[model samples]
Target: MATSAVPSDNLPTYKLVVVGDGGVGKSALTIQFFQKIFVPDYDPTIEDSYLKHTEIDGQWAILDVLDTAGQEEFSAMREQYMRTGDGFLIVFSVTDKASFEHVDRFHQLILRVKDRG
Candidate 1:
């Protein structure tokens, strides 16, 4: 007799998407969160994924973190990421007023795409 392998029910998975304006440190923040190292330079992100297995409040889960591009040039790709994400980290440069403005736009778009109002 042949046996089938099934995924463990105890394993939980999560997708976290990082969104923000260019040069706002989105990649740096995501990297630092799991690696504890600070990146001192700026680089444009096309798309990047980082995986980490973690336990929170005694519950085990795997996090698939998606670091995304911050430029409007990549806006067309944002909705795809937004839809697949279980959660989002919206970011903006504190010292740059324009980035703050973009944050609002990003938030609205996420709400709209996720149909959350």
Candidate 2:
């Protein structure tokens, strides 16, 4: 027996921001998902580089992932992204524990910005 495809309920357009520290697979995931290429040993992203915009299923998106220095120390960079984004992916490497611990405060930052922009 076979079942038909389920239609997606109407959803508004979204602006997404992927946030994480350096060398935590954020760029790898973005390149793989959008560009459809995977370079296991690629170069790093400079502080300022324009990532390509892409469309999927009629929804327009620009994968503007952010890279902030001092992941171990607190910074205001993430709050800046959360201000304009409709959604986010806060990534941390499974192999690293320190990266995981720092995720908490960023969640709070997202909440605070949600009310503004």
Q: State which candidate has the highest lDDT.
A: 1
For each candidate in turn, the TM-score is: 0.87, 0.62
Give Cα distance to truth, residue 100, candidate 1, Å. 1.0
State the lDDT of candidate 2 residue by residue for 19-108, as single tens digits.
666667766776676668985874555433234444556564454544444343435566666787766778787987877876776676
Score each candidate by Cα lDDT. Answer: 0.88, 0.61
- lDDT per residue as tens, model 1, 1-117: 343443346678899999998999999999899899999999899999998877645666788999999888998999999999999999888899999988888888999999952
Candidate with top TM-score is 1
On the 0 to 100 scale, the lDDT of residue 89 in model 2 is 76
What TM-score does candidate 2 get on C-alpha atoms? Answer: 0.62
Q: How high a TM-score does candidate 1 get?
A: 0.87
